[model samples]
Target: MVTLRSHTREKARRSTWAFLPPEIRRMILEEISRQRRWSCASTVCKEWHAIVATKNLNRLELNGASAEGLSKIILQRHLVRQIYLNIELPAYTCPQCRGFASSSEHGKLAKDALRKLSKALAAWEPTHHITLELNAYSPNDTDHCFKNHLYGFKHENDGDLLEKQEAWDDQRHGWVKGKQVRLPTTGAIQQLFSTVISGVQGERPQKVPAVKGVVIRRQMRRKIDRLALPKLLKQFPNLESINYEPWRVLFHQPDLLDSSCERCDQMLQDGLPKWPKHVRSVTIFEDFNEQIMEAIRSGIDPTISSTSMQIENGRRTRYGLGEAFAVKSRHLEHLSVSFMIDARDFFTSCKTLSDWPRLRSLVLTTPLMTKGPQHRMSDFLVKAGQVAQKMQRLKSLVIWHCSHDEASAVIFLKNKRSRRNVHGSATLTWRGTRDFDFSEEVVETWQQVVCTCNSHRGYVGQCDSHQLLCRIERVEGEIISHGDAIHHLRLPDGVIDPTSLRQIRQEGILQREARAVEAEPVDGSGEDP
Candidate 1:
């Protein structure tokens, strides 16, 4: 089997790589890893495959991946550091995705798949940062557009085939309804965790496998089951960190409780459940309803109030929560609230931030530039700056979902810098919304090309058009601004246009330069001598 010439040929083939120094080989490997060329590199040789699999394949995202397929991947790459498991209902199926069909097929499938995944993970435990994201949107029916002609369809296990349900708000205006599907329960998700712990116990024999961190994004369908949440924490007593995202569901049903409805006997008897003190971070995205608006406007407690949790304005209410929302989680280091909590209320009610001594990262998001008045937004930002100054341990203050207001961003940056002392321990970033309305001034300043419609008509007046406006300050404000584009185009990062943003910045720079030139002395540099 080993002739001298044949062996020499094999050695020559391998020697190409072996001839290079180990450091040079490592540099080549790093370059491939940086480029995410794992699959290509693995095809080179067995030794290369091993090295690539061990180092480069660190983050695994399993969405609709089969249990057997997942097990093989995990077994091969035991060094995976993070896993994002996204198990969603098939855009259009029940028995197809799940194995059997029933009244509660979706729920059953979720529970079963989760159990199998947990078992697989337990069989081969890797130090992983796990994030579980489950989307509740139904695949078959996503047409939010309302067609007045299409109506009168019977409900079934599958959502109605009709495009939209119609509503006559008064006499003239017609409203189209969005998807009104019920939210899946956390009961199944909680059970999945128990299965994981049990499997870990079986494997370890004496001790359970240690979970590094878990982020759960669970959407509530009906009411948040008070008993289910407490049970989750009770089961996993060792979990030191958890980032929980809770959403109050939206659906249209006769028996469903709206904000206007009286609290049923069951809800009153069940009362509110106290969240565990150990939960390090919590996010609540409330439905935009009259109750929620009132809560933001007049400071009403959302839990006790009968508010229909319906989403509106392409955004949800974030600050319309009850007093007991996260009072127990004193150790919370990271907090993100999207609610329009008043600046005054924050300064007064949120004095407890000092209590959260461990708190470092605070993200507050609100649809201010897009929905609320400019005056209110300015006040809120001012108060946020004040709060940032007081928080001793805060490392980052992220104000997300701000409108593309250069003035506001400049103000925030100025305040942030002003607050920083010798150490300059804190950093703040203003994350503008990708979608922002172009001001009439900016629109007017930009030269317009000849309208295509006018090319045939030989008409040169501003093309008449209308767009879905984000927000208007006054009721008398013009809905359709003249000479402006009808529709707004958005960039990848959510801004309407990067070029327009750059133009705005350039204009500001030019204006400053002009002012500097105007202020300069005529002959010398002396001031009006």
Candidate 2:
């Protein structure tokens, strides 16, 4: 009686593929890495498994695999170029609480799993990329941030107003609705990756394990105990890039030095740098405070409007993100920052863009842009122009402003042309998306602007001095009325009133009729008499 495993193995041994050379077998397995359909191929026999294990796999997704199993795989294989640790947890009865559990517990569980994973990674050679996607739980269902107010539970006797208040409370704290939760300490995260680096260093003191990039797909709602960034970067001395989701602001406390303050202090001291100069790219995420949120909703201060490109203290001093980051990584080439409330200050602080000589591409985005006052957009354009003035290497500038104004939106385009005409020619592009409900006249003007630029057909020199390429698109839901390119402008229909167009057309016809009467020759009989 032959079992299935045995039967498969015997058949694989007798197959024509079994006679292929070792190099050909390795090549076939390598192709499997590209296709990502290795399950069927690996089941052929032990020989096929041996071949698949050794080739360099660019990316390995451990969906629900155990750390021990992953460790075994790492031990058998060479370096895995990238690793995605995908873990999913659902709401369930908590054995500890003996009731419904929340997402905080799941977060803690993820930390523990990563601790084990870090230890496993330290035992093997360093990997280039590691992405943590542990927070893939349903955003609508997770109740980690929710809280219950006193008398908040709906009463059978409570009126509609009270019920509505209770619902608002529920919605506010819904992400964390349960009992008090404890977030993972910075030390735990540091030890996880540092353990691997230290362990490998102790065994082979001569070799350096350079992990180039680290990405965090999960949002960090709580502040770590210490500066996890500095500690982690010290381990991977050659780290080049880091992409992580946003965390809440690290508030200033009398006893605690926030990461920003600490970095600034470190920079002032001229001590050993926290991160390597080799770092080239960083994507930073900023938090939202009540003041900034209000400004975003209502408007920004008018006093700072005059000093758009220059540095101005606006309402409050901006966070020292750009200053501190430049202090640590002087050689950075690419930087993208997403701000919740710090958009204004971040722009102000970037006036020192010349300090980072290597910087080439900068991307700035804020949810506030969609609702910001006109002054805020004006200030942003000024700051962007200042940055452009200082940075000779800057070639790309992308702004995601959700506003409706032709003059403010194309400020960069105007600035770029000015610089090109004066300075040596540079390949400069000012690109972004604007959400506007355009009036018929505005749309006509924008179309003319685009057509005027296109008619020149010159790369740069022959084109009208002030004219540059432009695109305007009308978007209805997911469908687009324009071409399918990233630069398409999205305008929904109802944003512009049709009645306004009719009034303007009627006025134009009246003006034309009066002009014709004035231009017409007087009737021969009545004019001279």
Best-matching candidate per TM-score: 2
Q: After superposition, how far is residue 26 of candidate 2 from its true place, in Å?
A: 12
Global fold similarity of model 2 (TM-score): 0.47
RMSD of candidate 1 to true structure, Å: 19.6
Runs in model 2 deviating more than 4 A are: 1-40, 43-58, 61-65, 68-71, 74-76, 86-112, 123-210, 219-226, 247-276, 285-317, 325-330, 340-343, 366-368, 371-379, 402-529
Indicate the worst ten consecutive residues by lDDT in candidate 2: 520-529
Residue 467 Cα positional deviation in candidate 1, in Å, after optimal superposition: 45
lDDT of 1 by residue, 246-285 (tens): 3232222224222221232123123323334445655432
The Cα local distance difference test for each model comes to: 0.35, 0.39
- Quickly count the clashes in candidate 1: 8
**How does each model score on TM-score?**
0.47, 0.47
lDDT of 2 by residue, 1-529 (tens): 4698899887788786757888887787778845544656655678766656444344565533465455576344454666665544443321312222343445455555555555556555545344332223322222322111111122412553323333432323221222122222222221111111111112211222435676653232333323344544544555677664433332222232332423433332332255556668766533222211221222324454343212111212224544554444346687665432234445566665545577666655443444555455445555555545455455455554332222112312223445447532222222234443323333233233323454345332223443333333333222111111112332112111233222222322322232212222211011100
lDDT of 1: 0.35
In model 1, which regions exceed 4 Å deviation? 1-15, 27-50, 55-57, 61-65, 68-78, 88-103, 122-210, 215-329, 339-347, 352-354, 367-390, 400-529
